[model samples]
Target: MYTEDLKVRFYETDALGHVNNTVIPAWFETGRLPVFELFTEQGNLYEVSLIVANLNVDFLRPVYFGEMVTLKTYIARIGKSSFDIGSEVWQSGQLCAKGTTILVNYDHKNGHSVPISEAIKAKLLQQTHPDHPLAS
Candidate 1:
């Protein structure tokens, strides 16, 4: 699993004085940077060969500003041409939110999905979380 530490900014808070629901998705995206690197060449955006197919988020607790939070990301499942990423946000040892994002390997030039290479699959498997259902 990949972990990232973030400080909640005041501007991210809502009228309820906690982070807005929208912010969690952005945080989850940030946590996926490592995974993105696996599909790109030297962190080049032009080399990205994947596209987000779906995203889901569940808020469990309110996250407040000025506090540090940790975002954990892991490969939840791998398919022929797509994969699911599981992510979580924790604040003060509490799980604030959890999410899943599905990404499909694509051939941008051809405008179609393509099977993931075996080498890349091996790399992704290394990132699977032990607690995930699909983890060996």
Candidate 2:
């Protein structure tokens, strides 16, 4: 339920003057920082790193440059060693695109997936959304 507002720059548009499809994913990634901070134990995004394991996006409508867009992010699920996050981009209150991403608990030093720490699991559980799908 966290939101971040982003401006649609002209350079983000394609030849048709519509925001490029690829840009939505980038927006989602950008939006995740604030949401992650809300439920983080250390109150910092730098304390941990989330690595994407899977991503699925759905484009609902076209967005033009010079528009103010709102990116909404939330935690959908938390697993033993992974988590699922959801995001939606809205232009003037209308959905432009929505997506879900599966992220793994990563050991940056080892460069491999690791189990979610108890502290992280507790924080994520505390922020669970009833209207959203949640998993372990």
Candidate 3:
């Protein structure tokens, strides 16, 4: 699993002083940059052949502003033309949220989904969690 740590900023909080629900998805997106780099030599996120096909976020607990959180990311599964990234947001040793994003490998220039490259597929297979629900 890969982990990135970040602190909740003042601006990310809502009127109740809790981190806003909308902010967590943005965190998930940013935390995947390193994973994206694994597929592209250009080092640019936009240059990758990926598009979000689906995203599900479950907010388990409220996080206060300035609280430190750890975002854990891992390949949950790799399908023919899509893959799932499982993520967790933990704060103060408690899991505050969990998320899964399904990304379709695509030929953007051709405007259609495409299979992941064999090299990328192998990397994802090696990195996928053994116990992940869909990994097998």
lDDT of all predictions, in order shown?
0.92, 0.82, 0.86
Off by over 4 Å in 2: 35-47, 126-130
Q: Which stretches of candidate 3 lie over 4 Å from their true place?
A: 130-136
RMSD of each: 1.4, 2.5, 1.6
Which lDDT tens digits does candidate 3 get at residues 1-136? Answer: 6789998899999999999999999999987787788778878777888889999999999988877999888899888889899988999999999999999988978899988888998877666655665564
Steric clash pairs (candidate 2): 79-136
On TM-score, the candidate that comes out on top is 1
Model 1, position 81: C-alpha lDDT score: 95
Question: What is the Cα-based lDDT of residue 84 in candidate 1?
Answer: 95
lDDT of 1 by residue, 31-120 (tens): 988998998767896698989999999999999987899999999999999999999999999999999999999998899999999999
Predicted structure 1: lDDT: 0.92
* Between candidates 1 and 3, the TM-score winner: 1
lDDT at residue 58 of model 2 (Cα atoms)? 96
What does candidate 1 score on TM? 0.95
| Candidate ordering by TM-score (highest first) | 1, 3, 2
